[model samples]
Target: MNKLQVEAIEHGTVIDHIPAGMGVRILKFFQLTTNGERITVGLNLRSGENGTKDLIKVENTTFTKEQADQLALFASSATINQIANFEVISKYHVELPEAIDEVLACPNSNCITNHQPAKTRFYVKQSDQAPKLKCQYCEKSFNVELFSELN
Candidate 1:
């Protein structure tokens, strides 16, 4: 029998344990739009003789807290593996923050976050609390913001 092998990278972040369908969404959410050769993603891969899983390899890529937080929200179960010299160096666990920016859109009709050329803002809100966001411009409730796109 013949066997094929793949070499591990010297350094990079490998995201594993992503829920079945969430792998693709994570790639797009980060806007991996540049078509960079450094990024790699494998979906529905067999895992340790068990069920299928997903994996993402970002070559020489180190994520900021914000980026990791964003990933957590989408796939809380995902595990981050730091690889160096083709071996696991560190294992990172993902945690979802209470809020995520540029992710959700304000539901308010007059919310500036929804207008052209505006950067979206996400905030933690309470059921009894008044407006959510302190508008940078209009100083009104941008509180209605909700996740605009699931992907």
Candidate 2:
């Protein structure tokens, strides 16, 4: 028996276990495609634990801890793998951040971040359904999905 494989990168980051259907949103949100890096994306792949999952491999790019943590909004079960020389050097799961600033644009059009020079800020509120992010500018709580547009 033989199994197909995706080519491994020499040095980069691999995001695994993304909830199926969120991979494209993440790619667009992070502007990964605009950076000119080779990105391989697998969607709706069979998963032992989650039944289905998405995976992303970006060559020559490493995501910071803060960036990885932000991914928890879309994929709480996701894990980041730092690869070097085609080997995984480090691996860890993404954690939801307490607060995030200057990354996601507030969904509210009337928010100060959209009108003035104030940076966008949100306080994370984890819930059983979905994590809500309360915009610091307008004081409105919105589910993380609404803040996917990058600032």
Q: Rate the local accuracy (lDDT) of all candidates.
A: 0.64, 0.88
Q: Count the backbone clashes (under 3 Å) in each candidate.
A: 2, 0
lDDT of 2 by residue, 89-110 (tens): 9999999999998888988888
TM-score of each: 0.66, 0.91
TM-score of 1: 0.66
**Which residue ranges in model 1 land beyond 4 Å of their true spot?**
1-7, 33-35, 48-50, 102-110, 116-119, 124-151
**Candidate 1 local lDDT, 20-108, one digit each (tens):** 67788778656653556487777887666677777788888777666775676556778888888888888878775556566555566
TM match of model 2 to true structure:
0.91
Which clashing pairs does model 1 show? 106-145, 107-144
- Which candidate number would show the highest TM-score if scored against the true structure? 2
